[model samples]
Target chain A: MTSATRRHVLQYGLAGCLMGLGSKSLGATTSSGVTDSEIVLGMSAAFSGPSRGLGIELYRGASAYFEHVNRQGGIAGRKVVLKTYDDGYQPDPAVKNTLTLMLEDEVFALFGYVGTPTVTRVLPMLKKFQERQIYLFFPFTGAQPQREPPYGPFAFNLRASYRQETAGLVQNFVNIGRRRIAVFYQADAYGRSGWAGVRQALKQYGEQIVGEATYRRGSKFTGVMRDQVEILKASRPDAVICIGAYAACAAFLRDAVDLGLQVPIANVSFVGSENLLNLITQGRDDGERYTALLVNSQVVPSYHDTSIPAVKQYQELMALYAPSAPQELLTESYTPFSHSFVSLEGFLDAKMMVEILGRLGETPERGALEDAVFSITEYDLGIGEAVSFGPERRQGLQKVYYTVVDEGRFVPLHNWQTRFA
Target chain B: MSMPKLFSMPRLFRKTLFGVFFLFGVIGVSTSLLSIYAVDTHLSKEYEANSKGIAKTIADASVNILLNSNLTALQSLIDQFIEIQGVSYIYITSETGEILAHTFVPGIPEEIKAGDVNSTTTVERSLPGMGDFIEVGSPILAGVAGTVRIGMDTGLIALKIQRAIGQQIYLICIIFVVGVFAAIWFVNYAAKPVDGLLNFAVGLAREQSSDGAKSQELLARNDEAGDLARLFLHFSRPTDGHGKGPQSGPDRSKE
Candidate 1:
């Protein structure tokens, strides 16, 4: 052949490769956050702040599940990648980080967002970009906004509402004949949400709160705990339900015990059970009497409860993924896995997300994912109960389990009936 | 032998009388309607403000007591709210819609079901036995706890409106009655010159001198009635000041 004919053949081959690359880019751009070999998700949580345990551990648990799936040849042969930004649990930064995730990173959906304050700020941005159809799945709050109308359409919750948690606590207490109740809450949306739940639950038993006190939203529990303890002590309540974070709750409990007030203090799961226990038992006695009296409502079952299929799976997954947990997490009190309620909740949320995504077939679009979540009805999540959703029901978990700190570890309180009887 | 003009009235007097009555009627009706509208609007706003205020206070006190299982305190709180002037019923409800303490018999209204306490909502409803009342739902601690509902009787608002309307009606009636009397007096005073002119014309037609003095007095005045009287006096006598009267003239007046 002539030299001119060989050159013409090489040019034609180069143009063909260019057309193929262009087509791939067009296909990748058509889907919001899906590519030929990847599905990218975005999250904004407090990865580096005072609340890092919740945000970082929740991310860790979720990433562990995602990594496990990726290693098993990925979901539908496409790797799940989560890009998270540290909002520091503040609303302003949360808004900026969420917008960056939506606009710059161009992620498909928002997953495992933490805090009611942060989520509240993120919602308006979602509303502004509603046509984008960014599904906020399993936010770490039972605040009413995520469960009610307007915002409900955009949010898919995995845990029980604060109302349910407080209701369970109130019901159990009332069953035990503890009629005189008081509330200690942080003065914010999260605290108020749990506070509301306690009220709702008590109302069912034809009872009302005897006293209520509040600490500042982001207080470090130094000076405010005294006032809260004093206020609750004055009420002489049979039990005090605390709607606050681990530090504040731990401080309040410590002060209450120090003041010789021996009433039972209850906390909802949002108190971060492991963190709260760590705070309570950090420098305190190993078998403090207050430790046994402090009860907490857990949205997820006990980390050591291998009887439940989910707990077993969670432990196995944690062992496989998080091989080097912090030293403090391995203390004699609670050693069944890293053992953080927030982490377990995050794992469950990711597990459910994978379940829903797996059900949506190979190529799930944005709207299809949302519709699939709503269509989930009576679907068992292997935690001794089934999660269901409909047009009206957005919350997946309705049952709340109670646990008390004993010997510096959380133990399931399954005998409220016999004890009360 | 000319018959007196049947029911003769001065044209000016008739127009003035009709105009006065029509103007008074428009003013009376407009004033009455405006009074009713103003009274109703003010009363409605006042009742709504009062009802919402009571509902908010009850909600603030309710959540703590509800959670603490203080049924007695909750009951006492509701009782105290019930004593507020227009409050017909007050109730505390769980987030699940259970009523803890309620002054009403049937408990929480169906319109205000559970999960209906997300925000501050108010509705004017008429209960079967409670009569018409404005129902307000305020969430305890921004709806984190539960809801407090207060039903303020529309009876007081209605009564206020009714009393205001009655007073307005009475005032309007007084205005109308006074307006009628004033209009009559004004019309009579305004028509006196016309009456004089009419008598002058009648005397000219009958060739009489009794009404001449009155016509002279009317012509002395400076008004439309005076001008009319002057014209009547001028035509009744003659073009000249001392021309022949109707008795000696060609007697066009008799014809």
Candidate 2:
């Protein structure tokens, strides 16, 4: 009512508006792991356990690319740092590591998680923390849970679903008149997913799995499974599709070989082809070729195929970077591969993540991450396939490649009939 | 005058009770001891067998996980088995005798670590502070995949046996108390007639006549006591009539 009182109120209002503007300007560094100088992404994968190769190699590959980018002065000039934790390929540990990555380390996004069981468990965490704009990017699993709702919107994938890989394996085998296929898988979500994929693929041809056996997840190669091999052998399967890690699969192969069950054993890419082969043929004077009938399905192009530009770049960058896995994660002595499919996929995931970040411009915010990723209509990954993501499409690649061991190395399988026969 | 009464009852009544109690004490105590032994033996055997079966199943199921050297899954598999009753601990070892997984919380017991639990047969082991155990081992892959050892708690087995024995003891105590009450009631019923006959004889010695009807009443009953009373009346009546009374003796009857 008085002149002095009116003047003071206007002055206070002007000061309050100035403070709001100042806070808004400071908030530009926005999002937990995003800062003016660095953007950190979180990864919770199996850096240990029997499947540690998957996590380690995936990390190594991603790290190789991140290093390459950082050397070129980072993603959009802001250094990209990956905050990683080991889940040992188990679900409970995966959940714990995921929480630590998001809440404690406050990583910008979760990326490169290594297993189906792990990712399925972590999906709920992302859905719950969606308000924080926390999303998982390009996890290294082909399980269907992350590709479908109500968990689909929470993640963006760069690999083909296990369904695609299994279906391709099943179709190829069935076309070769191998209808009586048996399955041996790990007794977990990952295994079940592959089994379901095989079942779904077989349904189209009116075929069913002749026999199935399961080994517990994390089983090692020191144990023998002659009885399991016998169980499957009785089915008189034309072929066996094994959905498991390299250790258990290799051990199964040993028992199968010993039992004289001379049927083709097909393994998915998650089995780690190189590791499986090495495990089967590592010792003894016999030098028996255990991989004579072994086949593996992969989601990425063969690392040996230098004709593909992405593979060329991946092989070069991986060798140049020579990214060794985090030492403590080496828990046991695991000699890193010079180049592999798993690492190649990891390299592609890292490159794609960088491209997505590049779209957010200099000031990247968590709120705009999904849109930035979706905005890419067709980004050439130089793998002869275009990588794309949109509202309707969450995965970038749908191709599946098959490989077989030759001379202790995995080479692309083209002549399926001759090779399998 | 002779021995203090355990319960306020006549000597004959007390004697009858003593006979009953003595018989029951011998039989009840022996039966209880036998039952305790039998139950303990049966449970020990039953639990030992169950634990062995568990160890065997674990060995069969653990082969793949063991072969892969996946200790986490191996640990989880064994951990689930420990939830079974009487199963106290589970330990897994590699083919070369390296430890892979165990269920002990404070670290594997030193005694267990040192004890040879790898035998195919169930072996009994007594740890210093951890009580006794029946350790059973099953060879995975017939010793190619090492062995699975499960320890069934002997202390727990003994405790269950003790609990069973405790209930049996309580039942015996209850039966004894009921038996005593029944004995007391029977004693009161049988002793009343004898007491009547006792007073009559004592009265006759003091030259107090009468109670002939009471004597006849006791004689009318058909029991060993009644028969003895009749025989005594037959002999004493004729002798007293011949000439003996209280004045004939210096009160030979002692009360």
Candidate 3:
């Protein structure tokens, strides 16, 4: 080869090597690491795990909102960066990933990290960080600990809690004069938390759980659920409450119908994934036979209808940034209720982060962000609800929008004037 | 007396052409695939989000209608929902399984009929909040009460995604066709230098017996061809007759 050619080859090889090394170093640095022009928020979600759909939905919702904010010159001229990591709904990796974001990457906050077990494991670490005063807003879990005092000061809950949701579910049955109620709950913290709420709500009616059934998560409870359905039927309870995920809830409904036990089947919000509706109607000869399906609910403003200002804004942003997406796909059916929940919450969180950043006055320290969240009172998101936080109450949403499943979709029943249950 | 066709082209020129073509082919194909994947992922996520957003909008509008005491308003709301870009139907009911309003085909069942609502029949499917209906519920006013359910036809979204995927695949196919043609051109160009070298060796062999005395003169030309001529002379020495001798043959063998 010519001398010049040999030198050229050597230079190209060195350039390739240098590029590879640079990428490796960049990859090694966690995404949460913020710079002067941008602040990164970290999220670990069940992107590929059992609850992967929920995680993916949450990510989509959060990303849509963030993309919109960033387009509008971002929050106070500092671009918001959401660095999402998928933990596959597992707790160990979630804790590890969260710690890496907090310690190594130094993210300004942790936003919308999903899953109950996953968030539960990281609670202690989050508490430590909170002691140092870091903001963790709108974590996906509605577990009581994350919302109760001590840890509640650090965390901001976006969804109506299982307690609040269950109270709403039971209150619906109570409104219908269904005095004898039974709860079929998953045997976990989520189910227990909801069941506790149901029990507490029923106490006001001078009654208790007339019939209760529990099943493990991810287990096929068809036969067990059938037995529970039969037992619940025997008790002749006016309504059946389901405090579980979509799979369990769908299976219970399918099996209950098979057993010919017909009653109002109430469910928690977690069971509200749109896939469940398809599962329920998949092969049924009478698609409308499952018309009595009811999903107890909480949701933000709908993004499908252009009638609402907030929903219209959400659609406009989604179109601008995500134009390739089908216009119809922007509807609420596919995402279940998560799009409304996360988008509204994510926007509020973005606003709150901006407010906190403003409180710090130009250059923000982590301490100022924490104080800002704690100091928030009646921060409204234009959805007719004001988010308030105090020393005692960390959960911002006091109102729950109770919705029901009518004809294979969730329609709002009404906003409860008083907190149900 | 005719020079070989392959040896007519200079080896360096042929090799340079080959290197350029090969580099372009590799870079082009890799870039196309990477771009397609990135675009596809971005679009799929966008599609999913849009579907969810549409569903939420219908639910919200329905909820507002239910909150108002006007059943006529609720019916108008359902009609508006059906008029929405992607909505298929909107149904409203009470927690007691009473079908308050519906936007469906004719022949509504007695159980789901508007006036003949089934108060005895409760919603039995396992959904989130318990009620007789599917989607959102009208807040219980002093007298107003019911559930507002909105159903969206997702086929439009699916069709949109399919079109996007089809467009991507078409682009990918175009790129692949271009890639194949480029690869063929590259492989041919890359092999050209080797062809030239073979012809040069044949030319040297043909002239070998004719001008032993003039060989040194031929090798003195200060070009790539002359360099090869000199190397050939050094290799064809009597001691390297077997073409595997220790001294000069090893260097040629290394080449």
Candidate 4:
């Protein structure tokens, strides 16, 4: 018999077994408990933790996009139901919540799950459900682990990863003839990943990390920052790479200034939180003694650029969907990096999914969906880049634009495409 | 030789072993495919970016040379374009199809004559700096109106891609081997309980008789399976035990 026929027979047999076992009751349902018309998507994010700023910003962005979609009559005529759970930047609860979403809530797919550890825990579970054809997109982590296939086919990345962004940042630094770099990281996966990139980039120049320091999450680091300042003072490096959140980065900068370590402090894109510059400026105890030391790289374009087509579209969407949010929040600095492009990314991926669905012509099986994603080529997202997928490569956008904090604003450095170390 | 049975197969343990092996096999194939995809994507992107960079660099260098030089010197320097590693040919022309300078390969059409400075040629080919080979007449520079054409062999880019793919395949193989072992260990861990239950069931099925001594012996065996057996025995004999016997055994089993 043909492979198709054999597959049909096996499917029939599996269906018979499932029916006999009565495992249909194991499926998760919604609040109204509807399974067919409503498509539920689960997202676990750092909604109320130290990283809540990013979490809240991303939520607002994704919500705005979904609201716009729903208002426009939804995807393929079916409305998307986003069920968000707060993971509080912790992994244990994140795993529990994810299990609830998958096993109890039975979401159609997992969209916008945030954090590396949280997503890492769910990888095996996601692999198990690969046969069900669950699509995971814009997982907040830029860890290469998520983008590696068989996981990559199901998981799509929206933001450029820390590795890609850091490479751009370091290359720009190198272009400007700055070596003798110091690194201040969060002592976490996110921090270390960017650190790895920085180290790799600096390797080309025959330079090593001259000075290093780290901060534990949620700990007050005034004294620790003082110590780090002393270390950086001793090392006297040309640039200090900060790979922590806004608060930690702010503390380090303030302390570094007090210690007379007047080196330029550059940071990864994660430090692009709202009012980060305000915090740095606030830490400037004297009025005229403003240290010319603050610099942070931005992965996305400044939302303030009203001239950009993508930004214009985002503004329109925000006005229509999330009118309650302040106009300033939608400004260039305050807007989430992903906010500028998440909807567009979603639309592009959704478009691809629809094409695959059309190819399947009504009920596309899981294998067909996999094939469609794998077989993609010249798939233009209409944002900035075109996406192509083949038997071996799966990442969508590999380019990152570096911007430094200039006069309390992010100034564009030259754009650099990502490369593997 | 002795005649073999039509459907001879291995024992239950061996079957389970084969199942585990098959599971790993699926994971390996899928992982291989994934790694290939990841590496190919990474390299192709690198190649495309590199090509674009090379093109831009060549274009920039040509513009710089033209901008720094006057018309006579530019005409003399145009001949030096071939000396650049990736530049194939350089053509300098006016808005009117005048052959200001020409670096030609042996026997192409003489579209432009030396004194024919006022005739126009249509743009035919979509070459980088100028247009196609046949109709290469349009003016690139507006006021000065000169064109510089450079051709690069994409062989280096291809070689880079190939090298990247090879490296990636090796990395993927390493990851695959490690992942397979991890998957096997994990599957075995998850299936341990089921394996224990199956063993217990087989043992029960092979039991010679369901006598009092066997029942006492089963009760003495106080693990989870023994508790299940005791409960089963008590349920089968409705009135054999003292004061709610089935209830006690079931309550204990439930706990």
Q: Tell me the native contact fraction for each prediction.
A: 0.00, 0.00, 0.00, 0.00
Candidate 2, B236: how far from true, in Å? 26
lDDT of 4: 0.54
Q: Which portions of model 3 miss their true places by more than 4 Å? A: A1-33, A129-131, A219-228, A282-285, A301-306, A323-359, A414-421, B1-255
Worst 10 residues of 1 chain A by lDDT: A325-334
Better of 1 and 4 by TM-score: 1
Go through the candidates in order and give each one's C-alpha lDDT. 0.72, 0.80, 0.58, 0.54
Give candidate 4's root-mean-square deviation (CA, Å).
Answer: 29.8
The worst-scoring run of ten residues by lDDT in candidate 4 chain A lies at A323-332
A263: Cα error in model 3, Å: 1.4
lDDT of 3 at A84: 58
DockQ by candidate, in order: 0.01, 0.03, 0.01, 0.01
Sort by lDDT, best first. 2, 1, 3, 4
Query: What is the DockQ (computed on Cα atoms) for candidate 3?
Result: 0.01
Write candidate 3's Cα lDDT for A307-402 as tens digits. Answer: 766566666665566522111112222333433444444454555555555565555566666566667777755566777766676777756665
Which scores greater on DockQ, model 1 or model 2?
2
Q: Which stretches of candidate 1 lie over 4 Å from their true place?
A: A1-30, A221-224, A323-337, A417-421, B1-255
lDDT of 2 at A228: 72
Top DockQ model: 2
**Compared with the true structure, what per-residue lDDT tens digits does model 1 show for residues B1-255?**
111321144566667767877887788788778877888888888888878888888887777667765443465456556767888887677776655555543123445443354446887777654588787888887776778878788888878888988887788788877876676666666666667667777876887774455766765667766666555655666554555553333223322
Better of 3 and 4 by lDDT: 3
